[model samples]
Target: MLSMKVLFAHLGREHLGVEYLSAALKRQGHETALALDPGLFGINDNVFHNARLERRFDQTRRVLRALEEQRPDLAAFTVYTSTFPWALRMAREFKRRSPRTPIVFGGLHPTFEPERTLRCRDADFIIRGEGEGALCDLAHALEHGTDPREIPNLGFRADDDSPALNPLRPLIGNLDDLPFPDKGLFERDINFRDDYIVLCSRGCPHRCSYCCENALHRLHGPGWYRRRSAESVLLELEEMKARYRFREVMFNDPILLTHRGWLEELLEGYRRRIRVPFRCFGQPALMTDAMALLLKHSGCQCVEFGMQTVNEDLKRETLGRPETNEQALNAFRICDRHGLPFDIDHMFGLPGECAADHARALDFYKPLRRLNRIKTHQLVYFPGTAITAEAAE
Candidate 1:
């Protein structure tokens, strides 16, 4: 059997999805490499850019250069909405250079907008949702010269040059069965000394209108939200600590406090074995005295909460966030009492937002004693999110 060398192209920060897919492919006896483009000049990850500087330093050229050097059998990319265009540009250039080599795209953007993404002539195939299994299958089929279009969760252009999408495969029930992410892929690019990021869970519980989680939940059904076993998570962290000697750990789960029983068990193990200082996100409505205390005792340096709006009516009706303004305050108060530094994620410019909303947010946050920082962002309407449909209406 041919051992396909799969090249994954990514921009800016290290991507956990790409790492996981690479690990899966390697486990199946396929080789993988990363062509990381440090997206400079406001390409995708960073905010700093000068038009002149950007023109002088087209970072995609660097990625293309890597492509020429590696000349892998397949090129893959994991993309989000913000980085879709960049991914396309890179794909088109790769097609231009090596038309015979196939390109596959996966991740949040393609998971939702598979057809639109495949409309690009250069995009040979896309794997939508939970790609580790599907990608490995696709690679195996491709290496053995088998037809790949029937593979679940894969999308490709039909003989008529139209998008042909296969139904999604069943979601992976136990994340522990999968091998640990291929962190070696990004060792040279990422500063593991600062913080080692780990995703201990898959999918978010809440169906927030602005987020794609709801769409995912709709697609995958009730089991959409799943967490890694506490033992699995601690073992990964223990391995990471031994390898990188990381000063800090970052839980990149959508919300770290999904299951109380799991959280308590994880915290207990974390405190005892992997006691490195860490930070994670939690829903304000999910916070409790016991949970906050456990986090503090477990070496959590901070907790971040999404307090998108102070107006309860807008939050529920528009954002679909079940948490009320009082609940958010209670969460803050609980954190403060436990001496847990916390940050507030603030979003302005909702569809029907006004200056009063901003003022009210300011008033709500002004009195919080343990508020580490208020991270502000303008709301972005992704293509298939409920908020985008409502905004159009």
Candidate 2:
């Protein structure tokens, strides 16, 4: 089979999805490159032009030039709701210059809403589930002139303008079977390599209505959760250390301490071999004093836990989290006792929330302000998620 050149279009953000896919493609004998889009390349809005704007403009030009120069057989994108417009613009521009090339999109936005995404006309294919195996099959079918409609986890438009949404490929049960993500594909484009991200596991225990993670977990059916052996993770880090100099690591898992046994093994491994400073997510309901102490000893610099609202009804009925306010506060007390720096996440503009509710959330945080930092996000109603349905209701 001929080697295909694949180009991934992404915003200037840490998109581990593309990196993982790049690794898969590399293992299957394809060359992959990343084109990081400069954020806020507003095509219509006239904002005050500054040095920052000029620099962003120049970076966008460089990425577009890569499209013309490389002429990749397939151009892919990792689309987020926030970056969908920018991705569409880039895809249309790429297609305009090289109509023969194909455009494939993956990630939460397209995975949940392929119909809406393919409606763009420029998007040629959508990988609806995990991409490693499914995308490899698609590449093979495309190269061999096979029927891609038969491929799992693939969605495309038919000649009659109807959509073909295929079933998802089976989830990779053993995460260790996967190669270490090709960080080089993204690392070369970014300025700094000090802060790196690695996920030792997939799937979250919680069923948060607004969380795409939980929705995705349901997509793969039961037993979607999987974790890597501590040794497997340590080996990947050892390889990463050999290639690049990194100071801090961020575990991208929804909650790092899923199983106490696994967490202990990972922490023990980190203590013995990979002692880089790290931070990870925690859930108030899952917080334990022993886990906090182990994390502190294992060089945990910070922890982030979602406390989306102080409304107990909203937390339990709407968000699908049942941890009580007292329970949430006690989790922080444990962190404070362990002297572990922690932050809390808040959602201000949720479906049934109002300004008073936001203020009430602040009142709830006031007492804990000395113990943890706070960050708030506007409620994002992603398609196919329970929260989106609730919002519509």
Expressed as tens digits, the lDDT of each residue in 1-393 for candidate 2 is 687788888875667788889999899998888787655434322234366664666556777888888878888888877668878988898888999998999888898889988878888999887889877887777777778788888889988987778888789989999998888887766533588788888787778999887788778876777888888988988788667767888888999978898889888988878778998999887788888899999999999999999889888998899999988998888887888989999887766777888788778777763355787676778887888876787
Residue 110, candidate 2: how far off, in angstroms?
1.6
Q: How big is the positional error of residue 257 in model 2, measured in Å on the Cα after superposition?
A: 1.4
In angstroms, how far off is 45's CA in candidate 1? 3.1
User: Per-residue lDDT for 1-393 in model 1, tens only?
Assistant: 569999999977888888899999999899999898777676463467577776666677779999978999899999889989889989988888999999999988998898899887667899988898888888888899999988999999999989999998899999999899999999988888789999898888789999888878877889988888989989998998899989999999889987789888998998899878999999988899999988998899999999988878888999999888888899999998888999998897887778998998898888888999998777889877888888789
TM-score for each predicted model, relative to the true structure = 0.96, 0.93
Best by TM-score: 1
In order, what is each prediction's RMSD in angstroms?
Answer: 1.5, 3.1
Q: Assess each prediction's global lDDT (C-alpha) against the native.
A: 0.88, 0.82
**Best model per lDDT:** 1
For model 1, the stretches where C-alpha displacement exceeds 4 angstroms are 41-43, 46-57
